[model samples]
Target: MVDAHETFVIIGGGLAGAKAAETLRAEGFTGRVIIIGDERDHPYERPPLSKGYLAGSKERDSVFVHPPAWYAQAEIELHLGEPAVDINRETRSVTLGDGTTIQYDALLLATGAEPRRLDVPGTRLAGVHHLRRLAHADQLRGMLTRLGRENGQLVVAGAGWIGLEVAAAARHYGAEVTVIEPNPSPLHGVLGPEMGGLFTQLHAEHGVRFHFGSGITEILGQDGQVLAVRTDDGEEHPAHGVLVAIGAAPRTALAASAGLEIDPATGGVSVDAALRTADPAIFAAGDAAAFWHPTLGTRLRVEHWANALNGGPAAARSMLGQEVSYDRLPYFFSDQYELGMEYSGWAPPGSYDQVVCRGDVGKPEFIAFWLKEGRVLAGMNVNVWDVTDRIQQLIRNGTTVDAERLADPTTPLPE
Candidate 1:
């Protein structure tokens, strides 16, 4: 049990860190709580960075997880713009960038992840960007507005979620857009080829061009601004700007230096089902954690927003010596123009043998299920609403489902 006099320190003031602090107070922990963040702003939700915020549909205040006054009222100390430079496991203390040290009986590392950068030539050009933080999104939004006025083109380096969402937003602003991907189709690695093709078709229907199975050799620029992207096939796609959404890497330097176990497969801090690292006194959550998934029966690391939102509370409970398991089904959603989709359950590599669909793939609404030996492993609903609870129940129960019945819209999901 945590004593009222003990101190709890959290590094990285993202959604997860904020939520953990909130949970501690809600759970009646009278201990001192401190959160350190590298960014100048308070913790904020990041999903809107690429969609609503970038498109100017959301205001700056709407993205914050909590108001600035909330922390003061909750008795939580926040050190904004001060990054944690080091951690001493022996003393259970964290060193901040300003040469301040904070001791903690329990510590959490929610460092999150950073966008993978392109190492090719011309990447440092003024018009080439990567979206990760609010500032990055603001910069891109301004660029899109300027390019819209000039009728310039945007060349996206990857066809992933961030890339596609940015493409949709850019198109909404009337800027010509082209997406380049190394996979045969967009989101092929996650949604598979057939389902991924639906997204490709969606973009094509909106006048967005694609260059599949292509690799970017270099970015061409003029006067320190992006001019075009040169592909491996000797083709140059002209562009006024470029956005790279290749993926992200977990920020685990402090964890590694503190001698915490790191998952080699995901390059994240390794934790058990309770989200506790090997040290027991420290816990890791959100994008920087590779925890043993109870349902998938394997180590998995999720970069989605839902994981951070849910994992934070679960980790807080564990830190208080509560016997809790972070076994909630993983869930995530994405919005692009008129299309909105929500997916739940784990789809580990080679875990599912079949994919069954309940609605037409060519139409605007559909539910897709990934199954293994007639058991629902994962499910996704595209443009379909009010069925996520049913999908999660089916997966949690490990119910055996009939392929024909599962595919038929007339039959309701198991109760």
Candidate 2:
């Protein structure tokens, strides 16, 4: 039998890190489990920050991955509000911000990603915001509530998933929202112009002003409070609040400090199919890990709930010397106004040859497939349910499906 005294250290207080700690104990690892987080709050999921929490539909405690007492009950030591400042691979030790050093037999770097901030004049103004953390969401909820009460204007930069979701939340609060994006349509790089235009129409219908093909050059402020935003097109928009949703960057300083290989394609720490880093003792997961997929033959960093939900357990098993291949497909879901969407697999706009809609695009429900040489690379279901498994199977199977049947609504998807 293996020694029960082995120590496993997990960095980052997000969903992946929390799940890893839970999995270790559940898998019967009688080892010392330590989870260190920079944030003061308990580990929580990020998706609810923009959706349920921001909309005031979910309680604050609902965001946490587990109850506050669960850690103590599970024998998982938590170092809350303490950030890991250094990683010493030679000693297999990590130093916290408080100058405490911890030794580990295995290490998991689940540091997650940080929201990309805007660089412009007056960006430091009081009304400017970026949603990434639970605390930020709490502050934003109060801000949106006040904005709704006052009918204030909110100008958001970058029409990506977060930006669009925030716009929907603002509208839910009865606040005026204006989105500024340089692309031709919202999510142009992800969903392409054809699909992105749908979102453009969706938000516009709810009174959101879309200033496409333009971006914010500066935030106009008066006495440390935002008053308006100046666009690159030399247009000025009045705003009571500004949200910078440009996107996020992986937190790889710890990985880089430990001399782990960084994926050039993605700015995340590179790991093998087993989520193992260059050092066998170190593994990475969640937004921080750009793992190689055996099936896709490429490295990808997925910033979604599903990745953290599944990746951590896989990495935990691998750390326990169990065989594991973390080849889960990239998946994400989004809710905006009345439209709900679930997307599976990776089909970059340029990578796909054509997009086939299974139902009428004008209708409220449809399944869109991005295909290349008759092979499905990605599938997105709009207002559709319970087809994620079938869609992923198609992508994994790599079958050359008939385009005609795939487009016919009456034809059922292959099992």
Candidate 3:
């Protein structure tokens, strides 16, 4: 293991970066650790950006991983608001945006992603927004305070998790919300058509109108402010503003610049089972890194919060010379309106032979378990936390389960 006196430089100050630093300290590493991030604020939690926080149910300071004083107390040098521009592998150093070079014996890249913008006319208008950072949330919060409910309509350009959550938050603030999805259902691409239909109905019940199976042609605006959005179906919907949350692409410019292997498919930095990139001295985690899963025999790039928190510590262990590989079950959750949805594991694309759904999707409580060749591959839970957590444990332990028992909600998961 590298000595505590050795220097470690981490790029990005998001969840993964913060966790790595904390883990390193907990592991008794008193090394010179420096964290660099373009965002000025201390590392903060982001899951609330779409839920209670966006709904104004939680304070902004409550999401911080550590207050400004904690980083100073912990002696973790935080280079806030500074972006790393280049990496010199030969010299074992990284260059910041301000042309300062920091030498490091080990490096970690946890640079997260940015929101994907809608490419169309009037996208540059004053009222067009994309939710990805604290600044974006603050801007939208300001608009919410200005509008105050009636006659305040917001157009969401996608029906993905972020888009849907933002719409739900806007609705909570008494703003009329409309979602336009290019697919047949809001979450069709992520959860398949059958399950996506469940969410579509849920949103409709919450007074959020959906215009699916259509594409946006342009964002219409007046006096540099958003007024309406037009779709390819020749339908025009009035809007006070627009939010584009189609998805995200990895922030892998630093890795690519350092000549690390970039996955062509995911456009993210490719790492091994040990979370180490091509350079032995450097490691990566979170949304920006793609790793191969042993069970599926396929590469997976997770953008979920759980993956980052779990993978961050695992990466730090490997960086500390522990022979550990990050192989935890991938899980994600979303709060839409009044519904809670949680999903775990991965179902190979088009591999699930049957889907067993329990409870009534109409009653706002149900769970769907995906099975392939009689093995539980993945499960989606809506307002069902016990079964979700139980099934997650079963899957992690590789327990054999009866299909009938899984399908029937009457039988509890076996101990």
Best candidate (score: TM-score): 2
The reply for model 3, stretches above 4 Å from the true place, is 1-4, 396-401
Question: Which pairs clash inside model 1?
Answer: none
The C-alpha TM-scores of every prediction are 0.98, 0.98, 0.96
lDDT tens per residue, model 3, 93-115: 99999999999988988998888
- TM-score, candidate number 2: 0.98
- Comparing 2 and 3 on TM-score, the stronger one: 2
lDDT for each residue of candidate 1 in 1-415, tens digit (9 for 90 to 100): 3355899998989899999999998998988999999999999989999988899899988999999999989999999998999999899899998999999999999999999998889999999889999899889999999888899999999998899999999998989999999999998778777588888989999989999998899999888988899999889999999999999999999999888989999899999999999998999999999999887688889999999999988999999999977887889899988899999998765778999999877777999999999999889999999999999999988868899999999999973
**TM-score head-to-head 1 vs 2, winner:** 2
Write the residue-wise lDDT of candidate 2 on 335-373 in tens digits.
Answer: 998899999999987898989998867766899999989
* TM-score of model number 1: 0.98
Compute the lDDT for candidate 2: 0.93
Tell me which residue pairs clash in candidate 2: none
Task: Count backbone clashes in candidate 2.
Answer: 0
Point out the higher-scoring one by lDDT: 1 or 3: 1
Q: Rate the local accuracy (lDDT) of all candidates.
A: 0.91, 0.93, 0.84
